[model samples]
Target: MNKKRRLALAIGAGVAPLLVVTMPVSSASAHGYISSPPSRQAQCAAGTVECGPIKWEPQSVEGPKGLTSCSGGNSQFADLDDDSKGWKVTPVGSSTSFNWRLTARHATSTWQYFVGGNKIAEFNDNGATPGSTVTHQVNFGGLSGKQKVLAVWNIADTANAFYACVDVNIGG
Candidate 1:
């Protein structure tokens, strides 16, 4: 083989393994995030909410279940837990739809929405894999003013869950 061709082949051979190893991690972390009602992470992803490091990878706010933190208890994206970041909320009414933009869907145990520290809506996937998009109709009766909605996506067969905090100004 020619020297230039041989050198290019060597470079490709060296880079192939690295790309294969990193592919899964990139795909897994690109899974899902709340799209509608614009979660803190979503706003960051869309550049609607100016943030720190989280602006780069908004779909990675995931951690163990039973956590109440908005950033899914993950410190790498701790900016999601900060309310002072000026993340704007999509004004909502008593009932609104939350859309989950799932780039990689997993077998879901359930989806839950919490406001005022209470679950206002939930959906059981029953070990069924979710579609590319999952939407939940959440009702916030008697809820007023500005509120933070903690949305959790429990992955079935795993101890981890994805979290998104969608802030909203309630009206009607």
Candidate 2:
């Protein structure tokens, strides 16, 4: 080969690896999670509860729709489903506000809340993109005492939802 061609080839080979290394990695950025009243994953993220992987990615408890588990059926975040893990309980009235913090807001279909297998409240967004933070007024329906409320964020375009569980003491 010619001298100029050989030098150019050597430089190209060396720079190719560097360019690849410097490229930004595409990862699934975290979505949303219940922030107010401190969901199970929220407690882990805030260091109020000792947990496993969910502590690092509190907003990533994503799984298929219609799931009832706090981990969203994601085994990696199963720590959220452990009721004995001593999650912090926030005291509130019969009606209270639940807040969400979103890292990446997607078009949302509905926001559902449940307690003891019965749905208590739901807010329909009609496939609209939410803001960075969202809030909903939830009524406990005369329910009192310590309760574990499961919150689910249903995505509009996908058959997936994010999950969070908040422990609360109502009318305490």
Q: What is the C-alpha RMSD of each candidate to the true structure, in Å?
A: 4.4, 6.0
* Superposed model 1: Cα runs more than 4 Å off: 1-29
TM-score of each: 0.83, 0.84
Candidate 2 structure quality by residue, lDDT tens digits, 18-131: 766554221226698999989998899889999986777788888999999999988888888899988889999999999999988999999999999999999999999999
Tens digits of lDDT, candidate 1, 1-172: 9999999998899988888778646755566999888889888878987777676666778799888999887777888988998988678888899999987788999999898789888899899998899888888888998899999999998899999999998892
Q: Which window of 10 residues has the lowest lDDT sum in candidate 2?
A: 21-30
